[model samples]
Target: MDGTALLRWGRVCLDDLADRREEINALNVFPIADADTGTNLLATMRAAMAEVRTRGPVDALTTHDVAAAMARGATLGARGNSGIILSQVLRGIADAVRGGPLTALTLRDALRRASVLVRDALSEPIEGTILTVLDCAAASAASCRDASLADVALAAADGAAKALGDTPSQLGVLRAAGVVDAGARGLVVLLDALVSITLGEIPARPEYSPRASVAAQPVEDSGETGSAEPRFEVMYLLADTDADRIARLRARLAELGDSVVVVGDGEGRWSAHVHCADAGAAVEAGLAAGELSGIRIESFAQHGREMASGHPLAPVDSAGKLDGPADRGVLAVACGDDAAELFEEAGAVVLAGDDGVTAAELLAAIRAMPNREVLVLPNGALPAHDLVAVGVAARDAHRDVLLLPSASMVQGLAALAVHDRGRIAVDDAFAMSEAAATTRWGSLRAAGERALTMVGTCEVGDGLGLVGHEVVVIDHDVRAAGRTLLDRMLAFGGELVTLLMGAAARDGLAGELVAHIGESFPGVEVTVYSGGQHGDLVQIGVE
Candidate 1:
């Protein structure tokens, strides 16, 4: 198939699957009720689609490029167990078809290899799961002697469907619960959707009607209307860079506008999304030392009109216009709902962006609010660069803005806890930034690989304990790590210790950790609370 044709097929399949996500989500029977199989799959595919659309169509497009893009999307957008598995499946296919224009035989071999690769990637393969269904489907496809692409996909879908039906019977848990294997069923639906799309059957759009009544409409041509038409939406990736340079870049972007979203690591490679008028300037600014890829520019004026007419874009801007008292307004950029809620509770308006937010997006969010003056809190180290972009956008828009360099969530929370609401915006920003920086922050995260860290030699999947910017401990037991972290905090004469337990660690573990701290340090007060959950893990923040 041609490159454009392949992309079209992928997109159509994605749209079909997206339409039936709720049905796919309902199929979960095992691994408890908090299942996000369908949602995860959709998100993973959407990420790939975004990249595909950004790259557009090229005459000499190689399968390698397509596969590489898909793999990149999967890595970044992977969420749950099912999502990770699906990503691996795509990665395998990409690996198999690494050379060029795909023929029926190459495609079949890719599917066959992908099935095996997916199974190998999983630690334990269980029957009546997505893995089994995919394995059977691939076997069916491989056995066909003269199968075309359509024929292979149809056979694969058929095998998957049968496997899904038998899942309840194969697994005792599923039989007892009288429900099908959720993950397996979701995978079947995805494959079936792909087949249907290939056969020219398009699904209907899913309804998103909520139970709550709609609020009164704002005046159409009021002062708020112009703000809705943000001039531009900009996105780019930075090459090789450091934190100090990134910080300066952020300060520059901050002057642009309110809806800024700069996301990337400090190691020279970064991506940013911003909504502003001067997108050219924004792209030009990031061109220093790094080659920009995947640049996207959208006109919000046309976008807002489309939305008003019932064609809403993706839920990118959840934070509505900023208005009301300017004593302290928050400007935060984060991706997950749990993270956003954490900042919201700490008296800041949360803007959703993973890693970092662009200056244009930040400026747009700020300008959307009616407030004339505001304080920005970039909670991640990498996002600190966006503060500069926000400032630049703000100055161009003639808005007063103050940036509080709250480099991490811990610092942002601390600063919010002691914010002086009565002070001027500049004074409040500086004070909160300074206060947030002083609080000691540590995190317990799983090691991605077995390597020698600053703390010591650590194995993959081990719990890595970090104190501020330093590595302190690496172990397998989360509880033990928490205890060690608490002891270290107390050793620093820490009077008030707050343990923000992640969902995984929220099963009365925090109380136990607190008790351990209490026994170790008699005078200090320790508080335990939940930090919510995101993806497959929990986060416990200690202050």
Candidate 2:
């Protein structure tokens, strides 16, 4: 296949996985019942597709280039055990197509290489898991080497489906749970997506579900049939390491605990995962090997306890039940005193300062909070990687932290406006997230230097109006820029316009904008606040 075809395959895979993310998550009883297999897979695929899209235009890329990008992105973005294994599979396919087209023979070779690489990556490859399903697919692909690429993909998908169906018989955990292996089921979805792309039609597949006898059984505990599973799940990215050191790291992690997986991206970068009692030692072993980043250590014991109680939320204790009040806290990152006060008045624990809030500060703030469940609003100040790091660290410390994807301070306020302590944590989080997502946000800032933007050239002292990160309007007059921003934002249909005057905003700017909105877009309500935020002259949110 070509690069365009590969891109289509990635899109199809991502869409299919997105549709069945929660379903796949529900089948996660093996490894650990974190119920994030679907999330991990979706995240990994998204990272891959994102990288592919970044490689200039689709027409400019070759099959090898796209495959290599996929492998690299998957390696760097892989999460959990399943994501790591999936990375290896992508890497193998890339290797197979390095010097050839993705024909039936090369696809067969790709599957075979993937099986070997996956087995090697795992410290102890388990049956009835993704590994077994991959092996079955590879074998079937090998038998159809002389056929067309579509036929080979069909064989692979069929083999994976059969293996997934038999996973319960291979492992006691799945048998007890009366469900197919979650990771294997995810692989089948991927392979089916491949078949869809190759044949231009979706193949029929069995519904992935629990056996009839266990269909109604509640998941009280993780179906991990063992004396006692490891307490912690540690994962990290290791760089500047060699095969010898990776081997040693694997051996060391195996000594500490089980479920160890270390896979590389053909480059020096490697992703390591392990379930161990000594989380520190697991990380320390990687440190001895090379540099590390994205360090995440999760407690399975705490996770199990949480699962036993409920998936993500539970009823408050007797003292803080529906009749009584529960102390639900909101942690928001604000830029200045005005914004901080506004957040505090809205009942959020404000992390007020400059925009340079560190992960350490966020983690410390979360840990210091008395509430067990804390909602975090990063407010576009923190980077995505930093936000993820802080979330992992907070969870490691046993804090139930939910990071809302609020891109601006105004969006954070919009979310806070809908927060209700009376509702369950999950429902409250959903409501806040929905509010943040639906609000269209923009900002106005003075250009620091002359530069060419997506809109046009902007000189120093020019007012730049931006929606999200892209500058859409630039004008010499700040008020004109603000007017143009509102007009453009309102063109998309908004009933309410929320304006925050920044610390450096000119006097009467808010009133002028409100008047302009009233005259230009009648019936649109306007609310103004003194944000006192830095970097931007004004922040705007339309809902």
Candidate 3:
């Protein structure tokens, strides 16, 4: 319940998971024939562990803090379908704990809520998966009247183990494969660890033998890998809050994909997942439902080692260091002429996005790079598919790439300004992302449509002050609107202002803003340059 106990539980669970990972991976079948359930679960648990360790010192954290941190880490780093569901389930449990003392009643209630959350996250629930295993465990715990926490945990573990063994009889696919549900096996392992820790006993090591041995992919009649399921799996976090709107989104996504899942806090934030032939359409549905971020799209055929489209990790030598060639560089997507110049000046191979950019163009850009390991800054200025394509292409060529999510020119510029060519790629990426994060960027654009935005309705040609992807301010005058936006941004206590003037911007407007900034907010330096962006009269950034 507290931080110390939570840490102990985590160590036991993670160690058990690591030892049993391959066994779990071998048992994967239901939903899709992807043998990555173990990897996904491990990654999610690692993320949770890292979060707890990173939040200052472990000794000072409380039960509430650690629980919240684990949930947050799991939600952000969750991979694939099973991982996503597991994350929300952890979140549900965290919510139930909420800094309270860990007791039998609390544990029982948390387990019950975890199953409910997992069920809610799925569009169509199956009878014999990890969900069923967790529900059975929770039921066993709830039935124990006035039992100690240790006794309850042991009972839960026993129930989960039984349910896991019974999975083949409950699911036809699992029976056909002659294997138990991979995820259910993982849940049993976790509960077993919990029981061991609660009882202060050394956990029994699990045997790695699997009854059936086979790869995850299904083959077609032509002897190539194929599936009758959806071609692509798309996922992202959506921010909005209308119960009716969420219901609408659920219906729409169900129409678009079979494995549709839209679940999170009912308030305003939710994680959306769908598998469909059209990735773009699924994303558009989310956009119509709410604002979206952290977008990931994967080809079902190339499940890759992770089931999600992850690049193969760089090889580590006998010294346990990432072995790489000396030749390394940064490949940046430049949306404008000035942006290209800025990136080039910083030793990046710039791909100009003057016209529309495509996946093929991105691949060609990667091929053009002379470095073996390249830091990619797609800038989030182009379509998501293009960037994902470049990542896949880079992986195929065995080039190490670290893609930065620089969504605006200002963010890209911030990153470029901080990048050190001689430093390690990952370290430089962290520094650059930190620099980008410290700087808040926005644009002044004229609305072309009359629609209900998160900020409210906007008429045609209305001056829109945008921060990140959402419009935060609407006004009639461009110059005054820009100043108003600056006022709001400066209110957050920025040290300097960076302006990227558009072609449509007036000659003296940048100077005028600089002068105003100097007066309105003394000691705040202002710098400006022509951005040559396709739209938006002025782009602004604060650092």
Candidate 4:
């Protein structure tokens, strides 16, 4: 297939996975229970798709160039362990077929190469991960040696689906949880999408609503007891050219923590994930290994509690019963005091969010509301597991919560601006979600440290301009970055622009941006507000 076809495949795969993200996320019990394999995979896939779009469909792009860009894009955008491994797999496939036509043989080799490459990236390849599903798919393709690419894809998808079913047999944790491996499930989903695309049709899969599958107090836990597991889970991307140094770093991290999996190549880029008592020390090891960025530290203890609960960590109001007829309202997770007030004034019950948000925090908001039908705007990006758990919990509370997947505060604002209280809950949710999605958003933030991003290496204090989670530009001046970001977002055309400046944003920055907006996009209306948020300089929304 050509670049455009590959881009189409990527987008289709990403969309299919997005629709089932929560279902896949619920199956995450193994691999440390961060509960975001689906989220990570989707994020990485989106990055790869974005890269292809950037190359342009009509551009005179070679297959090799398209492959290389997608692989590199996924590598930079990789999130959790699943994401990192998935990136390596895509890179491997690209490496195998970049130089030639994608015949059945090439497709077979690509699958084989992807499986092997991902295995090498891991310090210890697990038997029941997406890796196994990948290998199974490759083997299935081999069994159909002389088949067409479409036939091979179909076989691969079928094999992966069967392998996913057997994941519980390979991993005791999955067996205990009474579900297949979450990562494996996601891999199968992608493969099935590949089958659909190769056959030139997005097949309609049977509708399946997911319910929590974890049985409380599994048999495997009967006599199993342990000291407190690692207090923190730390992950980051490090850039180092020396293989020997990366090896030593792995050993050092293993000594400091448990469930350590540091993976990558000698090509100067690696991702390390570990559970440890001292998060600072884990990060320090990465610093010694190379320049590190995209640091994420989460409380394993907190995650464990949420997971063990098999429900919301904290239930909303006591007795869990709504006393009367169901009403409808809006719930928005706000990052700052001012933002929260704005949402509240807009008739939305505000929940505190950003890095500190938890499932309980979201549940609390749902419980606080007397309305039975609630439209929830998570407002900020959260790990898939947390969001899914909150959503499930909200449903359990007998509230019909329609979660509008707002990845940014600005998106949440757009949804709020269009929210119609007079409409039925489902109708309002439909309208609000559409507005939130149509609104293209960007943010300006200062880099936390020297790190490798999609744009390039960004030093501490460098301005990072992002569209969604992808960093599109890096500059020394935040205003310049903001201007560039605005221009990029406005490229598709917009009638309204919303600017929310954080607490540390310079007072005149908005004025400067507003002036530029007026000059560049004459008739577009601009609305500015003090978001009072930290970490980010400014957030922009376009509609």
Candidate 5:
């Protein structure tokens, strides 16, 4: 096996998959529920990259070692149903290649084994998932009985592509959702990247140029003299004793700049780049991490002016301005329009969609707000990391930003309902949001193969009943599920119950759920309303 080729292929796979993460996430029919397949795959691939980095060199890595590393990475990092399936596929490949030299023949056999393992693992294999793609790839490879490694890989890629293209036709849910098989598509991209890398067709990196000269153009001789101080751009690596402490240092860097990129590992290693007027402050922040290395600073004012004269320079700072109101603003990261409007009506300036909005965006949003303090609501489980990232960004920017950990749509709605604009302090809003959030339960329908979770044994088509983080029930009948879920909600001695049914559930099941809730939870006033979206789903809240 060519070790260098292996690593190159892995990198290619990750880059290709990363490029389409948003598309994969959007393919989710139940957008409000779970759509983390892409994110989970990216995270899993990132873990694999870390393991690859630890390997002594391309030459030192045996085929077995590479396979083992990938399997371990996937096992530790995989998330959601799709992620687990992807991981299992990798595991199958690893097991098949465990005692092998990994030539074209071994690779072909491995692919076959991977397909079989995945199909067996799934209770009911769907036609538009990673499993389908892998199965097709294996069959294609097997068809070429006398092919080279490269030939087999190419065949596999082609087969995966064909499988991905057929996803819409194979799955009704995918067709209704207006997306090709997201998981299958992602897998095909990953395979294509690997094939490209194996064939040595890596793209070139652009040259880096300074940006300060272009940004520092002087105005015409108006009586006032402009400051001649050169704004500096700095890049450095910091090693901290503790990761949390580095977060505090990041908070300090936010006050100094326009472009700030602070990326740190949880294990005390950090890399940062910033374009700011005060280079010393940036350096000081790095010093807080204990020691610094590869420190480089250049004046950007001159570069900015040069760029203004039609000479383009590389951007100095990748981190754009924080997004929020200048005086009073709302920062929310959520999926679905209804969720966004809930926050908007609660006086929040909503950032629509999931991608492009990072921690820096949150900080920018908070800083842009007119009020000294800003409130942030992360309306989903996946965006929680981004919210934390924003918190760190806010702390670095020295902005008063409050993050309410609302894990579901219902909780987010509840939090918005109790938001008090008059309360300037975060503690006040935090208390109220927390209380309001507690009054509601978040329920969602499960997708993909059924599995026994910490919540319970959930099937793919079952309606999932969630009270907080625990999965209380999974049932086929919508009304029965709603009634059982409501009973669980009312057990807490709630006086009122509200059911917000999704657009899909409105025609058939919403009225039934309302009737059931009214009957089951005696003396508990039940209210049923449309979730105001198209979907055969319903949200039942017992207050």
Candidate 6:
């Protein structure tokens, strides 16, 4: 394809996708089912088109220039998990064709390369997805190496269509929902668009819809209410790093979450994505690897209604707007339901969830706050960069945002204990900061895997106790580990000990600790709470 042809293909595909966006979205049930696959693909294509359009008239650009622009644009502007993968497909085509004319051999090479790129980008490629459809298309094109361009396009589209049809059988989620894969259907649309541009025909394919039996079923199980799956989708563009750093980032992201994809534009620039419960940690990983831009974190539970309505969620701004910004409001990032309740009951606004809060989310919350001076208790839920981003952005919008350096739930609670809206902003900030800094904290985790730690090597199921991020005690019995951890923390003398029990904490774990503290550490106060946080069995705070 020449520059003109490339631009035409992108335009055709964009229009086709726009026409089918709703249909594709309706079919999205797998992969957390925020139901925005169609929207994501359309956004990605628009980005590609925008890039090539900036290269002057089609006549001014070579085939290579257009291809490269499309790839770069797609990579930079890719949205969501599906969009990132689609960007990789574009990158593959660009890599294969360079500036050469699109012949049968080149078309075959493009499809093959696209498939490989897509797979390589994903941390864990699954079957019955866009990957499968793209793979089938590539394999089909490869088989028709000697065919004409039109024939190759036709073969690839046909293969994608066939694969789309069989997706329900290959994937249990699709089979249960009685619909073809949403992403696979999208790939077929792109391939059919290619066929249209090359062969002047768009293949007729069967429409896919959720069966009546499953149509009313929940598209996703976990959400704002709570879910078993990871809760947040985190994406960002990373630059100023290398392959080695990107490799390490990929491994780190996989450890933190799922549906991980990190793809480069063949240049140093890369698009990184992950679906994780801890949105903060995901972005932090990217930050550690290199400079990051366009950081976006989406909570799945918070996405569906807005997406379905095709609008940004209206911020809670009616009262704020009418009354103007009030004297003060506190925005506390809480990791669990109980923690959220505790924060809210303390007269502070709470950003509650383990899904991790992003700067964008923080800014929105800040804008929605009725208070003129907003105190943010990050509570370890946001990275330093995000804090800076939100602070700058909030100031730009004329809101005063004070991000307290609280690094744990315990610290956040400690800060909240001292927040005085009646005090001046600077004084309040200092008081809260002081309270947070003085609160010593630690946690207890049930080791999920055997690993060497500061304490010693711990086996799976063993209890590991951490004091300020360092594991200092490992015991076969979690209860014993908890006691030992408390002894170490209280050895220096503390007036009060707060124990926050996690979701999976034993029934009598807190009571046992409280009783033990009463007997062993006489005159010290003990307070316990059901934190409901994940990963940790219990979080400890000493004051």
User: What lDDT score belongs to each candidate, Candidate 1 first?
Assistant: 0.60, 0.85, 0.74, 0.74, 0.58, 0.83
Per-residue lDDT, model 2, residue 105, is 86
Task: Quote each prediction's TM-score.
Answer: 0.42, 0.58, 0.58, 0.53, 0.40, 0.60
Candidate 1 lDDT, 390-476, residue by residue in tens:
554454333456777665566667778777655555556777877777777776666777888787898877776777656687778
lDDT of 1: 0.60
lDDT: the better of candidates 1 and 4: 4
Task: Give the per-residue Cα lDDT of candidate 3 at 393.
Answer: 37
Tens-place lDDT per residue, model 5, 477-527, is: 655676677677777677776666664553667666667656766676766
Error of 4 at 352 (Å): 42
> Which scores greater on TM-score, model 1 or model 3?
3
Per lDDT, the best of the predicted structures is 2
Model 2 misplaced regions, further than 4 Å: 1-228, 231-257, 276-304, 307-321, 383-386, 396-398
Ranking by lDDT: 2, 6, 4, 3, 1, 5
lDDT of 6 by residue, 1-543 (tens): 787897899999999999999999988877777789999999998998898888888898877788889889999999888888888788787887775867788888888898888888877777888889999999999998667899999999999999999988877777777888888888889989989999988889888778888887875432222224687888888888998999999989988888888999877789998887766567767866887788777877555533633543223344323223237789888888988898899888988758877656776787788765789888887667667646644642234678999989998989999986556666779999999999899999999999998768999999998998899999999899999999999999999888888989978888898999999999998888888888888989999
**Off by more than 4 A, model 6:** 220-228, 302-420, 423-543
Which candidate should be chosen as best, given TM-score against the real structure?
6
Write down the worst ten-residue block by lDDT for model 2: 219-228
Comparing 2 and 3 by lDDT, which wins?
A: 2
Where's the lowest-lDDT run of ten residues in candidate 6?
316-325
The segments of candidate 3 whose C-alpha lies over 4 angstroms from its true place after superposition are 202-209, 212-228, 265-268, 302-543
Pairs that collide, model 2: none
In the range 410-482, model 4's lDDT, one tens digit per residue, is 8998888888655555656888989899989889998889999988999998889999889999998878988
Residue 447 miss distance in model 4 (angstroms): 29
**Error in Å for residue 114 of model 2:** 12
